[model samples]
Target: MEYQWNFAPIFAHSDALLVGALGTLRIFVVCLLLGLSLGLLVGLARYSTRRLLTWPAAAFVEFFRNTPVLVQIIWFFFALPILVPFEISPMTAAVLGISLNSAAFSAEIFRGGIQSIEPGQWEAGRAIGMSYAQIMRRIILPQAIRRMLPALTNRGIEIFKMSTLASVVAYVELLHQGRLIASLNFNPIETYTVIAVAFFLFLYPLVRATYVLERRLGRSD
Candidate 1:
């Protein structure tokens, strides 16, 4: 027996899907900004000579990197409210988990990019009477960032997919909305297919961009 494919029901709930897409985009943007920004600070700490900074930063990176992101999200949503004074909403929990997880990963990318620079670069900056901060801001980061572009782009793509995990906590992302449509219309096939297509449509260009960035960076180097 062939499964009769029906999409009309899914189309009927287009408004819900649109809302879900918006929710997804919101979480993705928030996580991307917070993650990469925090990652830079954590990466700088990890790269520091001081043990005080390195120790805590190292622990954070290790903890997040070693643990599963899904668990992080669940813990933040379910367990954190007990310890904190304020309530942890689905958006807040999703943001905290995904952002911190991405931060741990991006920190390594930032650290490696910075370390890939030659020692002579630092020496040259010092010879020019530049302070550590000045050298990093003006010289090192500029060069390192170019090399890190592809990796960072890939990380952004990953963050976009990670937004779906928010659905587990009923955060009303694309997948969450799809689930609602599936359960109601009893058409999981058509519902999930649309969701998959939506994801592919959104992510394909980014995947292509990552390849382009790699090629350009390759030629530059």
Candidate 2:
């Protein structure tokens, strides 16, 4: 197949791409913070002694983890208003949906981190007269987080890439903007090449950071 290459249109709309990039960043940062916070709480809850606490947390993790994120996004964007009584913009809906979905997976990651700690560490903490909460905070969590840092970094990269799904909900993220530009100029190949490059530009640093953290953690161990 012979294809004519035109880089001019992509460059001409660089400003729009920049705006879309900012939006993608905004969604990612907000989602990461909120998701991590919620995930930590859910992870802790999953380990709780109370059935009331643990069951709900387990249910949430199962439901979200088992379902596709795209379905969840569609539900939030379309059915949420009917189920509830509040209005939400598509962008807000998209961000909230992805954040909550990511939280479920992150909770599992946190649980694994907590469980990976040697039982001897817990025994030592208790031997030192520390309460469960104190031991978790002062002894176990620190080491577990250090061990989990690479996994967490990888999750961040995954969430960043997943932000492309925001286009489905009419959130003007990078891929959506690229599509719009292509639609106007009739240049899918050129437009998508630029979009792919932009995605790489954003994600490459995160991949590098993950590798670096993995190495550092390996050395510390």
Best by TM-score: 1
Q: How many residue pairs clash in each candidate?
A: 0, 0
Q: Please give the CA lDDT of all the candidate structures.
A: 0.94, 0.87
Error of 1 at 150 (Å): 1.7
How well is each residue in 12-94 modelled by candidate 1, as lDDT tens digits? Answer: 99999999999998999999999999999999999999999999999999999999888999999999999989999999999
Model 1 is weakest, by summed lDDT over 10 consecutive residues, at 212-221
- Candidate 2 error regions (>4 Å): 217-219
Clashes of 2: 0
lDDT of 1 at 175: 99
Instruction: Work out how many backbone clashes candidate 1 has.
Output: 0
TM-score for each model: 0.94, 0.93
**Strongest candidate by lDDT:** 1
